[model samples]
Target: MEHSGKNKTNGFLLMLTLLSVIAVVAAPFVWDRFMEGQTGMIALIVVEVLLVIFIIASSHSLWKNSGSGEWKLKSDKKGMRVYTLKNPGETWLKIKIIGRLKARLASILTLMRNPDAADDVGMFDSYYIDGWDPDKDGVDPKLVYYTFKQKLFPPFKHREFVVKSEFSQDPVTKEMKFNFVAAPDKLPFNKRYHRVTEMHNRWKYTPLENGEVEYEFIYDAVDPGGNFPYALANWLIPAMLPFAFAKMPKILDKEKYRNAKMDYVQEVGEPAEAMA
Candidate 1:
């Protein structure tokens, strides 16, 4: 877990590094050209589209194969890595519960992060879980809610459980969301849910210097005891501040609270202690 936290901090730093380069080196060129052609309606559209793509690519889970199996995540580092456990034949894998950790992972936000303003598939502030499926021939412990949610049943083919929940509230957008996507169309399964019953908590140590750390206690909501959703939440999650600030004018001194140090979080590491 200690090493995992370090990895997350590293990955976030890498992401921030990538964005800073984009801003300091790339933005001026693009902005200059954009302003010159600002009067052209299509040019403005093109620039906006480019910016949106740039933001999404920075803040969401795009996939690649890792080791023996496929991994779906924006970064394979801790605090921001997602893992979806697959069925291993007759052997059932025992997964440690880290829902709280997963939430902490995605909850950390940085000033460098730009909110995803281009996701038309679904819209929300935090993690977005869009798909799910159960009893798909090889799944170890099948999920009942997804099984029923995707049903073609004779009235008596199912059972229901009473479920309950509290909420994760994002103050900036005044949004209350409770789930994060696990498979995101990149995995074998076709269903999704929040990583757990509770919302993941994130701590932003430095919001001013555009550096920070995050932790998440993600629930394995898709398959209560399964590893897929929990893994996916951690690996794929990214900073939500970028999207939240999409429409607003950039104000480093005033509108930098979310990106500022997260005093509400617990001590995990000194990686983000250098933020200004």
Candidate 2:
């Protein structure tokens, strides 16, 4: 997704800072190795150059798409309501590129090396209920098991839930959609004290006239009595959403459905793939 305006500028600055730190850390060792005529000196130099080029290219791409996705709060009744808008102007080619990048980054090796690995549900999380057909799936949706992590303080926190989903169609738009409403069963820690007591993560996909698809993701959640007690979590959740949303188009672009293929095995007793 493209990030423009102030957000894009901020992201550029952050990427620059990160690259600088990486260069600083590697300079001394690289210089010494070059001076000592290390066996792999030529290879090392080539790799270093390639790494810098990659960083530059990736940063440029990100800077260009900084504002590719947008979010807005629609309501805050029992819970805060938010939705996403994938910049209407974004081209299919750009979307495909972004999706590929996401898939590559979410690959096994990358997740294993990620410091914030615990903060991801990764590829293993998927759910489907028996006898559940979307068209016939009425108001009462079936329970779905999934794992997700919440960014809390230093170390990340994880939450596993057996959430029930509800299905409905938009009256005006006739958009088919489903929403997670309750976590009938939750991890022990979350059972007693959890920021998300009630949640409605609604996903709606619309087929466009141009043969492309548009997606609208809505996240509505209640923090029962304000367990977080901070305005930051509310804001952060919306900002962090684009990443997950962005991954969907990527999967569709590849014309593959790993989750659908694995759903039966996963439900029958296969252990979920641990994110690194």
Candidate 3:
């Protein structure tokens, strides 16, 4: 439920911005009544001062909150850490953070927000390479992302997020977390970071306590295969998203017995010999 400093700040600012606009638009209405009046002049000055004061106060808050909540991606030299990790089974990238309270809160927000939209099948996620700090800023391991392969990745950069699940006798709750999108100007590191658009869904098949094979759903997004490479790849993997959704359930149920265990088939060699 916690939001990143970046997201919370922006969300807060968005509300402020909207209100400012409303004030500006309504200024004329006020002017119509009070134009040329002493009262109008006093009111106008007060409003202008209040707006300026609000902006200044917010900027100051942002500066104090600005260390890492989301304004920009800082490199190690700037005290931010970086890292990248890949396993045959799992591919993830992460960043580390030291001791900024607000920064830590922002970090929490990021962890929760990433994989922003992964379902039982797949998700959309993003993060910097674990160790490639352009500015030497510390990175949080939790600030890692995944790769999703498709003919064409979405035009925008994805996000970071997480999900937690609970089970019960007859009812259970599934919880998910998310963070705010990075403002275009706030992404401090690389534009593409030499990465390409990518996405994927984790397929799982597990036998339930009831002798049925139930599955756990998970998803992630990654950067890989540029337009040219994807073109050559023949759009094969990317095109499967729809099919992934449609057939995932069927794939788990392909066999009539979700939990049927196999014993053994008749021995072909011995049986054939016996028949002969």
Better of 1 and 3 by TM-score: 3
lDDT by residue (13-126, candidate 2, tens digit) is: 677758765974686576665554664666667666776777765554554444445453333332223443334333111111111121221232222222233334353333
What range of 10 consecutive residues in model 3 has the weakest lDDT sum?
A: 167-176
Sort order, lDDT high to low: 2, 3, 1
**Which 10-residue span in candidate 1 carries the lowest summed lDDT?**
142-151
TM for every model, in the order presented, reads: 0.21, 0.38, 0.24
Q: How many pairs of residues collide in each model? A: 52, 9, 52
> Clashing residue pairs, candidate 2?
2-65, 2-66, 2-67, 2-68, 3-65, 3-66, 3-67, 4-66, 4-67
lDDT of 1 by residue, 166-195 (tens): 234343322223333332223233234322
Off by over 4 Å in 2: 1-156, 168-174, 185-195, 224-227, 258-276
| lDDT by residue (tens digit), candidate 3, 1-276 | 344666776678867956876776677577747565777787787887787678666644543343322222223332222222222222232122221111111222222222332332354343333333323456332233333211234653333222221111111111112222222232333444333324342322332333333332333334332333322222443233334534333433423223322111111122322321
Q: Give, for candidate 2, the lowest lDDT window spanning 10 residues.
A: 91-100
- Superposed Cα RMSD, model 1: 21.0
Candidate 1 segments exceeding 4 Å error = 1-25, 28-30, 33-37, 40-45, 54-61, 64-95, 98-220, 223-276
